[model samples]
Target: MEELEAELAQLSGKLELARESLKRLRITRETVTEVLAEMEPEMPVVAVDAGPPRSGERVVSAYAGAERRVIGVLTVPNWQPGMMPDVLPSAYRDIVEVVADAPGPIRAKQIVPRIGLPAETGKIEGTRAKLKRLVERGWLDEEAPGLWACSPSSTACSGSCCG
Candidate 1:
């Protein structure tokens, strides 16, 4: 009986070691995912296969660090020749400007001070709201939770010789 008890103790130690190894692996995975997201200049586009022909192009809408890549075809409505906003609202413009200037995704808190808003004034909520709306409008992409980055199209507009 004493021998069996000793063996059980050894197995428990091995089990604990395996769990620690798994935790390290998970952390590594998350870090790699964030790095990849930062490297991407625009949202990753993937070829999707589904349904009949659609008017607009199919786009990949998966968030960064997804455990299993969820591939789905999203048919853009309207399919307008030029859908870019001619003029963005002041607040929206400011937020997009910051995102465009950033080397990678910028968190809401980081943007607050840059935009001249007090970080402790609870005005960060306003920034977050605009970000979410911009993301929905395809002007920006949430590279990670609470991390904002400009879409490729928005960045292109900055270099235009529009006078």
Candidate 2:
């Protein structure tokens, strides 16, 4: 029992050190973003493949450190709504497409206008809802509140988008 307790204590100390390191590294959003741009101006892009989920394949989406719980059928490029009954909610699908096609981590403000409103992508309210939900679901990350981008470990997601 003493041995087990000692081992657990050592593990806890390591975890604390890792967490402290994170706190030290976290910085103002603006500064980190500028550094990223200076390092690589051309933002990377992510592509989702079209097919049924396969065993042990990465989760529908992955993020910072968690496997995004696959709550719905994932989306992929070239997916026509008619092809799958579970195509991503309309506006989100459009938003995803726009983000995927963009040269970089397009600002939400920029994309919403180009995709238009209350049509194929649905009303502004609907689009925003999808954006929020997708971010929560880990398909996207809240880079700057309203701004979003695919995560690093993302399976159907990728890129170094920040805004």
Candidate 3:
């Protein structure tokens, strides 16, 4: 009974430490988010598909009172007809290409090394987040839990890559 009591005390102490660490992490995340919000440029609402620029053309936006071309915003856009992978940033385009070339549904771990990222937990999780974003934007498909594949409607998948 004494040994059990001692073990319970130790477990309680460890739990307290874990709770504190989690609180610190949450606070850090909130602080970083606030900082980023302050640093981001205010973008004007531009109508998409104005018919002046051709499909896949980079959109220009005002940044710091200077006009700058925005190639890829953080959020992925829904895949549209005539849209190409070129519109995505290099990293996202690489992911699409990798998924398009894959023989079947792939896991983030399998995609990490193929995309030249080290097979680390952070890299894998980051890639997984991108995969989820792609799926959310209709650029990719999640066939099963943690298994990602190219969306059938995506030009990347329907193009020569599928052949």
Candidate 4:
């Protein structure tokens, strides 16, 4: 009976130590999360890059919709609204511009007329092909069959999924 009692006492002490270690682990996790949150940068900062903000250098602006970081400067033609086309073929660029302006996901058929392309069968098929390619290139997202929208990485568009 005394041996059994001694063993029980040792087991209880080990369990109590385990509980204290678990508590410390949880507290450490919470502290790491809080520190990460505090280190995050504010949204929508415009920083000038002319050796040190000269009087006339253009003040370029950028935004991070999520945890992604801006590693370097990216210059593209017509980056404002209704723009954001990279160095792509004119046909591909036109599709990007159209989708950027859309209030919601747009179908390939809808994009055809707006882009001044003919509504003929061949043109419609071509537009669908372009949209698929844009999805591959990460400039657009095809939310569903034939439906498309600009990707989050595209200028002026945000959100993880379809705009």
Candidate 5:
């Protein structure tokens, strides 16, 4: 009877220790999760700009099978309703002029050259703006941000794909 009582006492003590250990483990796990969560810092995100005021949404655009950052997105301004002319023809003529005159894809203010008209292609408004208009009218293609190229569409560059 004495030996049985001693064994029961030992088993009770072990059960109590196990319960305490389980409680401590739960508390430790909670503490670790909270600490890890607090370790991460929040990042700031700004909205999109219209003009040159650091505007525009942070849209992740895909280029050539890889993701790219959209540095800027400019909308077209002088688009007539009926005239709906081909955007690239006029712009292409101007780009050809500038390339024949002085060849360089240098930035002319906000307008990225080669993507549209050259900075010196015309003395009108912005070359980039013309490119945007052309893109809207299916004339040119903006392969990526700050990287515009003559579109490889059926109507635009017909020979390349069709032929």
Candidate 6:
């Protein structure tokens, strides 16, 4: 009986320690999230009345008997001859401009800080995702794995980075 009581006490102590550790971790996570939210710029919100539209489709809303097209802030439209970086979301435009201004190919990590984002892993990966999307849409080129540069055909790069 005494041995069982000692073991139970040990388990209780361990349980308390685990609870305390979990509480501390939760608090740390909350604080870090708050700090990050404050540090990051406010992203523009797009209100779509209907379900999410297919990529490259413009959202139209009828207001006062007139239809107005709304550009999605997160959409990356495929590049065309006359399409300019102005059509991209501000974040994407920033990345393109950074790449266009660079002397050669750059990595997401290098672009992150240049575009005013923290050089954290999450930021770098998010930037990499945008970079890949731009490549897919012909706004940028991937010379090799993880290396990004302005696409030669892109109007944003024609006279600047690619030249």
Q: Write the per-residue lDDT of candidate 5 for residues 20-88, one digit (tens) a residue.
A: 998897676556434433432221112233333223323332223333333322222223332222332
Candidate 2 structure quality by residue, lDDT tens digits, 1-163: 9999999999999999999886665443335434433542122212234455445333433223333323332333232212221235555656766765666565665676768753444455556676677666555566776666664444334432222
Q: Give the residue spans of candidate 1 off by over 4 A.
A: 1-86, 155-158, 161-163
Query: Which whole-number lDDT from 0 to 100 does residue 40 have in model 3?
Result: 36
For model 4, give the 10-residue run with minimal summed lDDT. Answer: 68-77
lDDT of 4 by residue, 76-114 (tens): 232344433545556776788788779989988899998
Query: Candidates 1 and 5: which is better by TM-score?
Result: 1
Off by over 4 Å in 5: 1-92, 96-125, 159-163
Please rank every candidate by lDDT, starting with the best. Answer: 6, 3, 4, 1, 2, 5
- In model 2, residue pairs whose N, Cα or C atoms come closer than 3 Å (at least 3 residues apart or on different chains), thus clashing, are 118-122, 118-123
Kindly indicate the candidate among 1 and 6 with the higher lDDT: 6
* Candidate 6: residue 104 lDDT (0-100): 92
Where in model 4 is the C-alpha error above 4 Å?
1-84, 156-163
TM-scores for every candidate against the unseen true structure: 0.44, 0.37, 0.56, 0.44, 0.27, 0.55
- Candidate 6 clashes between residue pairs 3 or more apart in a chain or in different chains: none
Cα RMSD (angstroms) for every candidate in the order listed: 14.0, 17.8, 13.4, 15.7, 20.2, 11.3
List of clashing residue pairs for candidate 1: none
lDDT of 6 by residue, 2-51 (tens): 99999999999999999999889767655643443343233323323545
Alpha carbon lDDT at 42, candidate 3: 33
Worst 10 residues of 5 by lDDT: 40-49
Q: For this target, which candidate reaches the highest TM-score against the unseen true structure? A: 3
lDDT of each: 0.61, 0.51, 0.73, 0.63, 0.43, 0.75
Top candidate when judged by lDDT against the true structure: 6
Compared with the true structure, the alpha-carbon lDDT of candidate 5 equals: 0.43
